[model samples]
Each structure stands twice: as structure tokens, then as C-alpha cells.
Target: MAETMIDVPGYKAGTWVLDPSHSEVTFSVRHMMISKVRGSFGVKSATIVAPENPLEARVEATVDASSIDTNDEGRDTHLRSADFFDVETYPTIEFRSTATRVEAGDLFVDGDLTMHGVTKPVSFELELGGFGVDPWGNYKAGATATTVVNREDFGLTWNAALETGGVLVGKDITITLDLQGSLEQS
Candidate 1:
């Protein structure tokens, strides 16, 4: 398939910096083999080196591990403990793109995700939300990306066996990124 379909209107070639106030990182995982637990983290920073062709962009981002919020103080604290993120030792989660390509009319970013002191390759399906100019005269762009990863793969293997024939926390997790940024012409 042609990469033409991946084009974004009003796109600019430059270095893009994430607007922390407008970007978010969220995730959900099955809990107790029944419901799901959703939480969010603060984006420390994100940047993209976009060329004339958006597909050639290189992306790098950091997430504050200690910023996890799940609407429950107890759970949040547990998530920050050694059983999970171990924020004291690994205070940040990072992702850096290795490649970008269009597949079946969708954009995919291949990257390495580092979390809990472990690094592994992952792919995020990206959807460009287009580009536009902010009221303040800044050129901006938006996009959403998502991927699924196994918690154990990152050394987050803590779990409890449920007498009901399942586990306390599911193995797989769904992660999503909602990003909006301004372009700095190179």
C-alpha cells in the first residue's frame, strides 16, 4: 500500500515538543479476571523529530512513574512499590521509536519501551489527528497511539492467585498516549 494515505494536512517539518498540559498517558488492565483497572501517569516529556515526511519522524518520550493515579490512594501507593513500578529505583518509563511504517492503511511505530528496569521492543499503532495552528500562532499537531504489553516482560511479575481460578492482576496491559505538540522548525 502507498504511504500517501498516511499524510497529514498542515503538517510541518521540524522538531515537535509535547505540550505537557495537553498530553496524557493512560492504561488499563484486567483485574481479578473480571473488571479492569484504569490509571494515568504524568508525561515528563515527549519530542519528535519530524521531517518533511511525517512517517520519517523519530519519537522519544518519558513518563513519570511516581505520577500514577488510579483514584485510590492505597492502590496508587502499591503500584509505586516494589511489587510494581518501584518508583524509587526506576522513576521513569521511556519509549524511543526505532522505525515507522504504514501497514494496511494504518501507521505503526516500532519502539523500545523501558520500564521497571527492563527494556523490550514494542509497536504502537498510531493515528494522526491532523495538524493545525493554535490561536496563539503556533503550529501544532495531534495524534493517539496505543499498544498492549505483558507486565511480566518488564519484570512487573507480581500477582496473587485468586481462589476463584484466576489471578489478581491480568498479565496483559493496554497503554494509550494522547499527544498534542507544537512544532519548532529545524
Candidate 2:
């Protein structure tokens, strides 16, 4: 097994730019009370700024709402309508960090997440997998983050009643982020 270390020289603190081709922002939601529907946003951008020798960092990101896809055309269209994301009116879901702290080898980033014109506070638990220089000589860093949010809170309350006395979908949506960024040159 390959052991990954978090510590890396020259990456202690600075600005990093996300390499979109190597990063992914995905989410999953419980559907029909039996299984999960997984999806990902195709368009996203983020930036991270770390202070020198500091154990914390700041992050900001934006995701294009219309880019949501779950491999079903009909469902994707529905999600873009008022029944769910309503991507027509709200084109983007954004996050801006207010505070960040590390606990037990994980990074907790507290930020405000805005969706469907509604803003709420949320936290993402992040794990710094490691940092290194890629074959092309670019400094690379990897991290994974996750968080859960109530769909109702973001005005995504669309639901259907199942015949079995339960709703067609769950209120809580779990978002998982696998991010890779490169250190920016001054």
C-alpha cells in the first residue's frame, strides 16, 4: 500500500488554482427510500488561499446549476425546472468560506452556501490527501470533502408521495468533492 503524507515543502501557504480536468464535484441523494441517485456538476471553479506556515485556509467556489447530470435526460431536464434546482432563474450555486480549522487530521471549512437564491451556513469536512509535483513539474495537491444538506433549506422541496406511505425522495443530499489543485506561480 502506498502511504500518502500531507506535508509538502513550498505548499505550506500560498494561492492554489483548481485544475478542472483533474477535479470533480459530485453529489448523491436518496431516491424512493431505497437507493441513491448520484450526479455531478460539469462546470465548477474554485480557488484556495493558504497562509504561510498556517494550518488553515480559505476557499471559494461556484457551480453551474445547468450542468447537473445523472445520465437521464428527462430527469436532468426536470431538475433544471422549477420542480428542483430551477436552473433558469438561479444559474449558480456558490460557497464562500467564513472560517477554517483543522481537527484530527481533517480540515473543517465553514462557509455560506447559496442555492435557489437562498443562503445558509454549512461546513465541509476536508481531508488533505497530500501534495507533490506531477510529471509535468506542476505542484499538485489532492483533497476530499463532504457535507450533507437538507434540500428543503435550499428551496428544493419538490417531492412525490409514494404509495407505500413515504416520500419519493429524501430531504438530505450528500455532496462529495474530490479536488485537485495546482500551486500558482507568483
Candidate 3:
């Protein structure tokens, strides 16, 4: 049996490979300034390198743009069109961490996010879910991170004026990530 040790500061120094089967990247946005629409994107690959101080970990991830699912086929199709993600032109969304820090028991990651041919700096508050061993004996670590961004910043400015005087879609988008990673024993 392989044992994984997690120190008091959290995280073990090693390679952390995201387990996509148990992880997800989700987002939500207001619909017409009234209701909210939620969706998730399939992550293609991800990696996290935890040094001696886990707070300064380096991270990188890639998501399949065309794999977005909002539960509504029509809406999903529209989102994949040029008006939004334009998956055909921009098939992948990526993030590369520039810095990481811990404050008041919370971890924050600042990174450059590129989507739709636009790159922007974004920060996400991370909640570490601790490390454990799965039933199958694999060492696992989990965490959740969230951030909000303006769609227009990414050139996703498509919208429609509603009869009620509001736009068809909201500009602010909330992105949430539920990550489960496998710790590599070096």
C-alpha cells in the first residue's frame, strides 16, 4: 500500500494530476437580469506542481470549448457559435498560473486565462478540500475555486435587447471549478 502524507500547511510536494472523472468546471450567468443559466465544460487536461510551499504551486489546465453543456441544446449550440465561444475558431480554453498565495487559511491563484482569442488575468479563491486515500488506494486531493468575470472582456459581447428592457444575456459570468487530483509518488 502506498501512503500519502499531507503536512500541516496542506498539499504534498509532487505532481498532481487532475482526475477529470471526479472534477468539473462550471459557470453561471444571469439570464435577462432575472434568472440564472448554469453550464459546465469538459476539461481536457490539467496539472499542478506543488513545491515545498504548496501556496506557491504552479498550475496549468486546458478545457475543451466545444464540450460546454448548458442542458439546453439550442442554447448550447448558440453559445458554441461565433456570437460566444466560437468553438470552431477557438477550440480550447487555457489557464496558466502566474502566482499563488495563502491568506487567512484561503489560497488564491492569479493566472492568465485565454479564451476566444483574448487573454486576461484572473484570480480565483481556492478552498482546499484536503487529502485522502480513495477506496481504490489512490492518493487524492480536492479543491474548489471560483471567480467572476465580464463576458465582454473576452469578446463574448453578443446579446439581444429584450422587450422587458433587459438584455437577453447577462454580462457577468461566475466560474467555478471542482477539482480532484491524484498525487504522484516520486
Candidate 4:
């Protein structure tokens, strides 16, 4: 038998909590002029709300900076040091959505992202993958979002120059968000 695709109804205009167990907040950046390095920050909590009568929504997310893990202790320590995230002074990275727009079935979340003590506006283009009741009797929804940001914009500009005349680290970082959330029915 062929696999069947289920079309789920769009999310109801209301508040939804992010299920961390099923959601991952990850990012990738160019490293050593060779390849890209990837990492994920553990999310503490997040909430999103959409009003029934409006086309916009609000989102707030908090991430634990100390949870940065790139599979290497040395690199992780360096990232948390003053040269990069400076996690000692700034323990959390936060985002609060200012506006949301839907285009071609994708949701663009425009928000203020605060990292390394600097706040900047960023947009995450998201697709509402789908939602439904799971076999275990839980309502689940999924979304995928992608965005790019300059490290300098968030005050994370530490880098070294290579002999070949290029910086060791790239300025632009690509962030990919694969989120699976559960609805808490009231």
C-alpha cells in the first residue's frame, strides 16, 4: 500500500506552547574556511498566540545559553567565552515576535531577537507542517522555519584571519527550526 498524506486543519487562533521534547532549535555557521559547524541551544520555554479576528500573531521564546553544545568541549567552551556568546554575563537568548504575516501558506515571524546583550530584528519564515491527534492520545503540530543572521549584528564578532586571506569564521549564521508542539486543551 502507498503512504497516505493527511491534510490537517490549520492551527486555531489561540495560544500554543512549544513542546521542547519534540522541538529542536539549531543553527549552523561556516568554520575554518572549510565547512559549517552546527549547534543547538536548549529551549527553556516558548509561547505563541494568534487572534481569531486578526492575521497576525505573537511569539515569545527563551533559550538557555549555557546549554550550547557542538559535540566538542573545547569549541563549546570557546563559544561561551567572552570571544563569542559570553554566556557568563548573558545567560539567555530571547525572542519576542512583533508581527506575523502569512504568504503562500508559510508564516513569517518578524521579531526582536536578543543575543549576546544585543537586540536585533529578525524574521523566521515558517511552514505549518500539520497537526493531529497522535496514537497515544495527544494533539501534535509541526513547523519548520529557517533564517540567517550576521554574527556581528548580535555582538558575536570574534574571528581569526587565515593565511589564505579569509576569516576563520563566517559572518552569516543559518538557523533552522524544526518544531513539534502539543496543544494543551483547556
Candidate 5:
């Protein structure tokens, strides 16, 4: 099957740096098999390299593992420990695109996601939020992408079993990207 291609006007070929103040990387996982726990990672750096052919575009992003915030200090500490991220050993989570394509007006990116020292292939569906000039007169573009992954696959397997049933934490984690970036060049 052939993949669709999009010519996003104003999303011209160049390097786009993700604006940390305007962008977010978040994740949610089932807690106690009944509730959900959410958290966000502070992005250390991110860049999108769009080529003359948009399908050839590439994405590179890094998140500060130690900056994970879930609003609870105690839980945050555990998340940074060996039980979860082991931030001291693996300081950052990174993603690098392997392929990019357009389908149904949305961009599909296949990439290698590295977390907890494990690397795996993952895919994200990105919806373009459009491009425009920001208040600071910088040309900007926004997009949102999401994907679900298993924590265990990344070596983040620490968990407790509930006596009643199920487990303390679920395996599946939903990751979301609310990305906004400024064009370095047109």
C-alpha cells in the first residue's frame, strides 16, 4: 500500500526547536488496576528536521528522566529510583525517528524509543495543530502525538501484586506529546 504525503505550508524545510515552555511530554499508567496515575517529563531537548520532502522528515527528542513530576514527592522519588526509571543510571529518555509518513492528514512516525536503558520500536500518530507567528514574532508550529507502550519492555518492571487481585501498576503506559516548536529557518 502507498502512504499519503502532505505539504504543510509554513512548515517549511528546516530545523525546528521544540519550545520547552510551550511543549509537554506526559504519560499515564493504570494504578492498582483501578485508577490511573499521570506524570510529565521535562524535555531536555527536541528538534524536528523537515526536509524538502516532508515524508523524509526526522524527529529527535530527549526527556530528563530525573525531572518526572507526578505531584507527589514520595512517588516521584520511587519513580526515579531503580524500581522505575533509575534516573541516576539512565539520565535521559530519547527518541529518534526511523520512518515518517502521512495518512488521513496525520503524520505517522516510527521511531526507536530508549528508556531505562532499553531500546524498542514505537509508533506515534501526530496531528498538526498548524503554524503561525507567536507573540514574540517567532514562527511556530504545533503538533500532538500519542502512543501506548509496555513499561516492562523498557525494563521498568518493578511492581507489587495486590492481595485481592491484579497488581499495583499496569503494564501499559500511554505517552502523549504536546509539542510546540519555533522554526529555525524557512
Candidate 6:
């Protein structure tokens, strides 16, 4: 059990390696000002250094930029070009926690998110999924976090004006993360 200000049961203190196979980084943005386009990036790697006080934990993660999948090959390719991610120039998206605290009874992690070679402070509202022991005896923990960012703020300003009204893509993007990690016993 965690002795932190927040109520997280079975929270173990140790270094945890992300279970990339079971974790995901997904996002959605309004398309054509009517529908939404959802996509996901494969997790390159993530690690959590949890202390007895969960609020003191440090999280570091990297997401593969070229792994973006939006169900459209052309758009994905475009996203990898100079107009967007430009994987050739910026191959990875990274996040490093700067602070963590309980706000209004909810856990929030403040971090620096680097994408498209731009770094900006972002906050993630975290929801603990509790901890458990898998059948193979590995101690595990999971959580879901989300935050919204303006694409233009990160320099992803590629969009075409629609003949009817708004632009082709929305500026605000919603990013959600479902992460599971295994505690590495020393």
C-alpha cells in the first residue's frame, strides 16, 4: 500500500519497466471540424521510478514517431514528412516528469513533452489502475493518463483550409495513454 497523500493500494516502490506490448499511446483530433481522426504510436520504451510516496515518482518515456498509424497510408506518410513529425529529423517523442501531485483528489503529473523537436510543459491527469501479481509472479501496475495539446504549439501546423469552413485538421489534440509496467526486483 502506498503511504502517499493519494489513495493507491498495493503501490510498490521500485524501478518498473513498461510492458510495451500491453501499453498504448493514442490520440484523437477533430477532422474537417466535424469528425475525429484517431491514431496510435507504438511505445518505444518507458520507465517509472516509484518511491514509497507515489507523488515522488519519476516517469520517462519515448514514443516512436514513425510508428504512427491513422488507418490512412497517405496521411501517415504525410505526417512523417516535413509538414508534421518528420521522423527522419525527429525520430522520437519523449516525456520526462518534472512534478507529480494530488489535485482535487486526483493525481496529476506535470512533465515536459518533446515532439517535432519542440519541448513544452504538459500535464497528465492520472488514474491508477491498481497493482497486482501476474500468474508468472511478476508484480505489475497500470494507469491511464490524458492531456490535450495544441498542435500548433508543437509546430505541427500543417493544414489546408476547407472550401466550406474550417481547416482540414483541428488544432487541439487529445492524447491518452494506457500504460502497464512490471516491477523489477533487485
Highest TM-score model number: 6
* C-alpha TM-scores of all predictions: 0.95, 0.91, 0.93, 0.90, 0.95, 0.96
Greater-lDDT candidate between 1 and 5 = 1
Steric clash count of candidate 6 = 0
Angstrom error of the Cα, residue 3, model 1: value is: 5.0
lDDT by residue (38-131, candidate 2, tens digit) is 9999647899998763445778899999999999999999999999989889999998998776666566778999999999999999777888
Worst 10 residues of 6 by lDDT: 1-10
Residue-level error in angstroms, candidate 3, position 112: 0.4
Return the lDDT, model 2, position 65: 93
Clash pairs detected, candidate 4: none
lDDT against the true structure, each candidate: 0.93, 0.85, 0.91, 0.84, 0.92, 0.94
Q: Give the per-residue lDDT of model 3 (tens digit) for 12-66.
A: 6889999999999999999989999999999999999988766568999999999
Worst 10 residues of 1 by lDDT: 1-10
Q: Per-residue alpha-carbon lDDT of model 6 for 1-186, expressed as tens digits? A: 422555477988899999998899999999999999999999999999988887899999999999999999999999999999999999999999998988667789999999999999999999889889999999999999999999899999999999998999999999999999999989
Error of 3 at 118 (Å): 0.5
Of candidates 3 and 2, the better by lDDT: 3
- The candidate with the higher TM-score, 2 or 6, is 6
lDDT of 1 by residue, 76-123 (tens): 999999999999999999999998989887789999999999999999
Q: Could you give candidate 4's per-residue lDDT for residues 46-145 as a string of tens digits?
A: 8877566334667898999989989999999999999999999999999998877765555577899999999999999977788778898877778888
Which whole-number lDDT from 0 to 100 does residue 94 have in model 4? 93
Pairs that collide in candidate 3 are: none
> What is the per-residue lDDT of model 5 for residues 1-186, given as tens digits with 9 covering 90 to 100?
546466777777789999999999999999999999999999999999988887888999999999999999999999999999999999999999999976665678999999999999999998889999978888899999999999999999999999999999999999999999998954
TM-score for candidate 4: 0.90
